[model samples]
Target: MSFLTFGVGPSKLSAETAQDLRNAADLQIAEISHRSQAFAEISRRALGGLRTFLRIPDSYHILYTSSASEAMELTIQSTVELASFHFAQGKWSQYFADIAKHFRRRVLIDTVEWGQKNDFRNTFVPTEADLITICHSETSTGVACDLADIRAVRHRFPSTFLAVDGTSIMGAVAVDIALADIWLFSVQKCFGLPAGLGVMIVHERVFERAADLIARGVHNPGVFNLPAMFTMVQKDCNTVATPNVLGIYLLAQQMERWNAQCTMESRERETREKAELLGRAIEKSSSFRFLVRAPEDRSPTVCCVRSDPQTITSLHALCRAQGIELGKGYGKLKEETVRIANFPAITCGDIQRLLQVLEHVRSRTPAA
Candidate 1:
């Protein structure tokens, strides 16, 4: 029997994506050399598809990594010299801040409550900070910071390198890519693909910053650093190491499918509609309410709900027993909330089925 899980990732794959994987294996795509011309064509096609699908500007350089966590590490190591500032709301944003601190860089973090949004208007970054980081969509709490907020930060701090973690909402939402110096995401979340590939769209300013750091001898460009990655991309559409060939192939195929069927604008509208439907259904039920209070702040890709510990647990079990799986909450809210994914791969019918199960469960449970 087939099952649907609303977990953040690794999300359910579409039939076409799965079939493409089988086709790749039949052709031995993964066994081919990264230096081979076949791989070059794959790389070129994938990059071209992403550029068209996302409207990535010609000024930005795209690079691939193992995961978004590695993207965070590489960005921090390569660009940040002395300090970094973070507008943190959830676990992922806080983790990025911790990664900066682990590099021995001074980190100044302005944090908000777990379920609340980050107030960037009152927040200030120190002049000493060379980099500023924000999670565009905080998967842990299902709160997405507005692109306008990012643009405002860029206007206030023109010289600082801005990095955004668009992990869970990249492909599903319409983001203003030009607003940030670096935007990164993993395909596992919104692209409905297997994990292990992270995409980073970097502005030329980041490259210049890395070069300046190298010139001053303040930071060594590691073998896997951004400059080195850029060099590899320029040379052969490859990486410093043997890349995930299958992942690249799958992403390229999925991107083309998205482009042909639903443009990003239409996808964003459908996603918002589905999220509103789910949010309203949950609000009407006594067992669950949205974790994010402000409707505008809630994520279109990931929906998180709050309820009592026992009720949340019971709901999870009920869904599982019915061949449906729901995501458990993350961090401190683990016992108090249930997380649901609203990715492009999950259809409206899937959500309707989930609502039916939720209603059935709610009718039997006592009001909290």
Candidate 2:
């Protein structure tokens, strides 16, 4: 059975993107040499489109990686010589902390309850921390750390390198790049592309930090640190290894259209509307409610719903029957929560159609 869902990601692609994919295959674009000008053009347009779409400043350069997790590792290993601080609100944020731990860097974390937003007003980051890792959107719990709160952290610790993980909301949300030194996310999640490709938007200061780490004889981050990657990217818009050329091609094509027909502002607005539509439907349902109760804390691109195991089972079965296969909950919340993606690829009518199915299976009893 074939299912058509655009939620979360490897989200379903639109007809236009599907055509682009087909065109790539027919033209044998993947067989081209990575060192050739053909691939450089692809990387150039993709990076340029990303800059325009995300409103990144001239001071920052976007580099390619295999995934956001790799970006996390590279970021920490590259910049954090002494210690790194994290705002841990969910699994993914904590995972970033764990990555820093792997490098033997001292990790200081300010944590909030699961599925809740980190309160930055009274938060304290140690002055000793050289890097700050903040997950702009937590995919695990559908929690979004608002950009304003991010600005608070930036204002408080201007000297520390602020790295943000915008995995679930990058393309769907409008992010002012000046808020962080490093902003990275997967192309799969919000950019409506196939998985295995990531983009790391990094400020020149991050590379400076890496250079400082090296000059001090403290520790060399390794072969493909941010500065190294930046150097290779400068030679040609290419990675040290053979990259996801197809994904890059598709992204370049998609970004061109996005920049033309739909700006980040319009997409962000639509994402909020779709997320609100899903949240309201969940609120109206008897069987489920948002895992994140506070409206502002909820994500504009990922919707997490909590319900009993039995109801969850029924919902899945029902959704699957309609070829709208819903994803199971994440990690420890596996039996309790349902995660739905509200990406740009998925239209408003599609969500409403899913809501109709949701309405039918909802429990008659009021949610507690």
Candidate 3:
């Protein structure tokens, strides 16, 4: 039987995206040389589509990496000279900080409890750290950092470079690209595309930082470092190495469709509506409630529910039996929470079906 899984990713792709993949294969997009004019045109179109979709500033340069994790690594390696500060609220944010520490950078992490907001406004970032990272949406606990808080942090530390991981909310929610000096996301989450491609937006100040580091003979550690990647993006909109050409093509097609059919504003509105619908259902149910208590702090894209371990496992199995899949909780909450993807690709009807199944499951089983 066909199934609809709400797992974070690889999420469902649209019909147009599926068709675009076939068309790319028919046209032999994967076989073309990365340096060829055809591939260059594809790269250019993809970059243009992303820039238009995200409202990226002219001062920022866009580059491609293999994944969001790689983007985090690249930002840490290329930008941080001695130390970096991170707002570690959940698994993903902590993971990013771990990457920096792995590189031997003196990493200072201000951690918040899971499912709570990080009030960065009052928090002081050390002057010794040159880079600060924030995950705009934490997939693990369904917690999202407020944009106003991010702006406040930027104002407090004007000289420190800011990086944001917009992994789960990029396409589904409205984002202010200028809030952070560097912003990155993978296509697998909100973009509803296959995995293996990440997009990074770097402001001019970040480029300057990389240049200064290079001039000082502080070489970036990774093979696909920012300076080399920036050089290629400037040259022909290509990557520092061979890229997932098909992924780029698919992303470009989806962006064009989104621009034509559902504007980002409409998408964000729908996402909020769906999230509220799910949130209310969870709140009313005896078996489940939102993992993140504050309504304002809850993620619009990934809605996580807290329940007893048996209930969560039974709900997972019941949903699967009905050909509907729900995401298991991540990290410390793995045994007691269930994650639901509220991405643009998941339609209102799909959500209604999910809720119906959830209600049926809850009614049949006693809350443990």
lDDT (Cα atoms) of all candidates against the true structure: 0.88, 0.87, 0.86
If both were scored by lDDT, which would come out higher, candidate 1 or candidate 3?
A: 1
Q: How many backbone clashes does candidate 2 have?
A: 1
Which portions of model 2 miss their true places by more than 4 Å? 364-366
Candidate 1 C-alpha lDDT tens digits along 1-368: 98888889888788899899999999898898999998988898888888888899999999999999999998898789889999999999998999999889999999999878888766878999988998988999999888888888989998888999999999998888888899999999989999999999999888878888888987766688888889999987888999999999888888888888987799899988888889889889987888998888998888999887888888888899889898889979999888899998888888998998888655335655
Instruction: State which candidate has the highest lDDT.
Output: 1
For model 2, residues 75-157, the per-residue Cα lDDT tens digits are 88778888999999999999999998988999999988898888776788889998988888888898997889899999999
Query: 12-121, model 3: which lDDT tens digit per residue?
Result: 77667778888988988889999888888888888998888888889999999899998998898778999999998899999989998898899998999999978888
TM-score of each: 0.97, 0.97, 0.96
Q: Rank order by lDDT, top first? A: 1, 2, 3
Clashes of each: 0, 1, 0
> Each prediction's Cα RMSD?
1.5, 1.4, 1.6
What is the TM-score (0 to 1) of candidate 1?
0.97
**Model 3 segments more than 4 A misplaced:** 363-368
